[model samples]
Target: MQLIAHRGLVRSAPENTLAAFADALSCGFHGLETDVRLSADGEAVLFHDRTVATGVPVAAVTRAELSHLAGYIVPTLAEALDAFPEAFWNIEVKAPAAVAAVQTELKPRIERQRLLLTSLRHDIMLSMAEALEADTGFIVWHRPAALNSLLYAAMPHAHLRTLVWYYESIDLTLLQQANALGFRNYVFGAQTDHEHRLCEEFALHGLITDHPEFVGLTVTPPLQ
Candidate 1:
């Protein structure tokens, strides 16, 4: 199974920052995943949460302001992509507000590297699929919900080629269902040693993990 570092293996540095991304690369992970949201100033910044420690909405502040409150530099999507041209990217557009910004930011970069864009919002995935020929995935939890998205994609021929399931929701039946439809099955939130061990026996297309070392070393894909 392909192991993609979740939020660049966050430890010392906050996730979605250049520092965390660098740490992931240093650990020999070729694939890295992060979340994107738009700043008040219209910058497409790499951040996972909707609110900060002060409970202020991330969208309410400019990137600079957010950085100051966050106490660490928050890297923009372009900056992160530029810094890690060698690694495959799994970028999750975390909020609806980020959809437009992410599209604009990624338009020029998609063709430059191997990447997968995912979102829990079907509308965002549909929007992306319609806008670009790049691979888009529906992040889902329940089997019926995942099947619903698959059905829609099949009839309309969407760019959706992958299903990103929550780790707790994964089961043999679900994996079989995804494989039967010829869709890539990537599990998110599988970070602990127990979680990694549980996934070891399953044939997964990829895994979004915070602990890459425990997931066993899968062969890294060739970089674009």
Candidate 2:
């Protein structure tokens, strides 16, 4: 199974910064997952939340403003990709608004086979799958039967083959149902060893974890 670093490591540096990501890579983690959002200027940047500490929406601020308020260098999606060219990335586009900017950035990099673009928005994931082909996309953070009826119907099951579910939302029955539909399962938000062990018990395909070096995990390189 693949053990991707969640927002890199958050050990020495703030989460999602280049410094934190570098720590994960230096520690032998080959898969890195981070959230992507569009700045006010339409620049694709790596950040986790919809809002900052002052509750200002990230989309309302330019990248420079965000960096200053955030108290850390907020790296662009391009900068992260360029700095870690060899690492496999799970770039979760956080909002529908980011899809266009992200698509533009990813189009030329498609041939690298090192990216898995995921989103909580069904339309966004489906759009990427349709545009970039199936394997490069994952519908994120939901149980299969719980997806929006209309939106799920619009999803091409044969094209998009994977789901990245929150750890709490998944169980064997849910996973079985998803597998019945030909979907591969990956669990996210697993921080403890027991939680990580639960993923192993379910025979999950992969998982995203804050601590990639946790015990009982094989921590293999990501699919390239």
The per-candidate count of clashes, in order, stands at 0, 0
The digit string of per-residue lDDT tens for model 1 on 195-214 reads 88777677788888887668
Model 2 residue pairs with clashes: none
Question: Candidate 2 residues 1-224, lDDT tens each?
Answer: 77678898776579998988888877767688999999998899999999999999899999999998899889999999999988889889889899888888888887874888777776788778877743544554555565445236445545577778887777688677677766777788877878877788888777788766563423445446
> Which model scores highest in TM-score?
1
Model 1: ten consecutive residues of lowest lDDT? 215-224
- Model 1 misplaced stretches (Cα beyond 4 Å): 145-150, 217-224
Clashing pairs in 1: none
Question: Which candidate tops lDDT?
Answer: 1
What stretches of model 2 exceed 4 Å from their correct place?
A: 134-158, 216-224
- Range of the 10 consecutive residues with the lowest summed lDDT in candidate 2: 215-224
The residue-level lDDT of candidate 1 at 78 comes to 89
Give Cα distance to truth, residue 77, candidate 1, Å.
0.3
Angstrom error at residue 101, model 2: 0.6
